[model samples]
Target: MSPRNTRPTTPRSGTRQSPRVALTPRAAELVRRLRAEHGPLMFHQSGGCCDGSSPMCYPYGEFRTGASDVLLAELGVDGVAEPVGFWMSADQFERWCHTHLTVDVVPGRGSGFSLEAPEGVRFLVRSRLLTDDETRRLGPGGPSHGDASADTSAHSRSGGPGRA
Candidate 1:
């Protein structure tokens, strides 16, 4: 009988690190669903363009480790993170540990979160800004593109016109 090939392939290394966020129940559900549908998603914060912070979800294909963060390890079948046990760049891990923002895995339309900066600053993005590719990659029944506008309208209705 011929011996069978039993060599295991080495895992790929140096993927972008997942951002840290406080996950609400809603956000957690969204992450679970995305992982099942797509390979993996990424979260990042960019401060160059707009004033308000933005959250973005990237398809596995578009994800990369660009001096920002590196994938540490898979967080079971539901999520991922960069801890000592996982394969992460030293800088990425250090940044995650020291960042003042708190990250959570909650139920949301996509696998990302927004923060309200300490000084009453808003850190979120509009659904309209999401490209069709992002929506599609996020999979079915996830947060729709109109959700951003809808959220603003709901807030306006509750706060009324005269309130600061």
Candidate 2:
């Protein structure tokens, strides 16, 4: 009998896997363009209402985040030198922390506050719960950074909010 072949898919020693958030090819192209026109960029995931759970992109420092917000992951897009910050409401993150996020672009109108709205496309988030291995690799930190006093609410929530 022939011996069975086996190999592990895990990263080799000293190698590190990227965060849970990723950008689709089209999303990456749009992010590059937005970064060129707008400078630094950040993404916040909406829980519901307004944009309906879509990930909104804004120029860095435009939308303020607070302790009620959580930094899910930092996405490194192809050709973009700076990693994009991905945040969520602390309440929302509680529900989504175990899922992997993939930013994607689709045709149609999005929130005007998002940098991509005027480009005839909208940024969306495709998500799925993380696998056991991913959960282990990520370890256990839900929230990354947020100031205690800043308002976590944004335009995607009820009554609409500010852009910059």
Candidate 3:
């Protein structure tokens, strides 16, 4: 018998509210290890230029976020004191706002700047269209650091309520 590297960390059983972003179990395990080595961490997906399309992880506050960036989620991993913040460029978010992202670990050398690069594994994003319920729960503009309010209006499974 072989040991498994992945496990379910978030409730995907359709009972709990779904997050805009989540981590695969393997990714979560790696996050714990990285946290041990680097204190706290944050992730940013630039979606273009030097970063290419891979998500980059760094020690918290190492990367300077500006008004053009949006926080997509704060992912929780067991044994870690603070949640890992995941941010995306605002333009990228606007294009991908309809999808739910899952951060997964893959074997490859990604951006040299990402902390995990030296570990021989990289973080990547997997996505699926947000379920109708999830879209409404997350509200129209996606998650903001201070926003607690969500719009629960009825929107069809075909698409969210006009992306407004």
Best by TM-score: 2
The local distance difference test score of each candidate is 0.31, 0.68, 0.67
Better candidate number, 1 or 3, judged by lDDT:
3
* Candidate 1 lDDT over residue span 24-61, tens digit each: 33344454555455534444434334523344433332
Between candidates 2 and 3, the one scoring higher on TM-score is: 2
The residue ranges of model 3 lying beyond 4 angstroms of the native Cα positions read 1-18, 145-164
Model 1 scores a TM of 0.33
Residue-wise C-alpha lDDT for candidate 2, range 1-164, written one tens digit per residue: 00011111223221111446777777878988998898768788888998899999988667788767776655555556555667788888778877877788999999998999999999998889988877777765554656554333232233323333
1 or 2, greater by lDDT: 2
Error of 1 at 131 (Å): 37
Evaluate model 3: give its TM-score: 0.76
Can you write out model 3's per-residue Cα lDDT over 1-164, one digit (the tens) per residue? 10011122456422111357777777888888998998778788868898668889987766666556666666667787665767777788889988888889999998989999999999998889989877666654454431123211111122332112
Q: Which residue pairs of candidate 3 clash?
A: none
lDDT of 1 at 70: 37
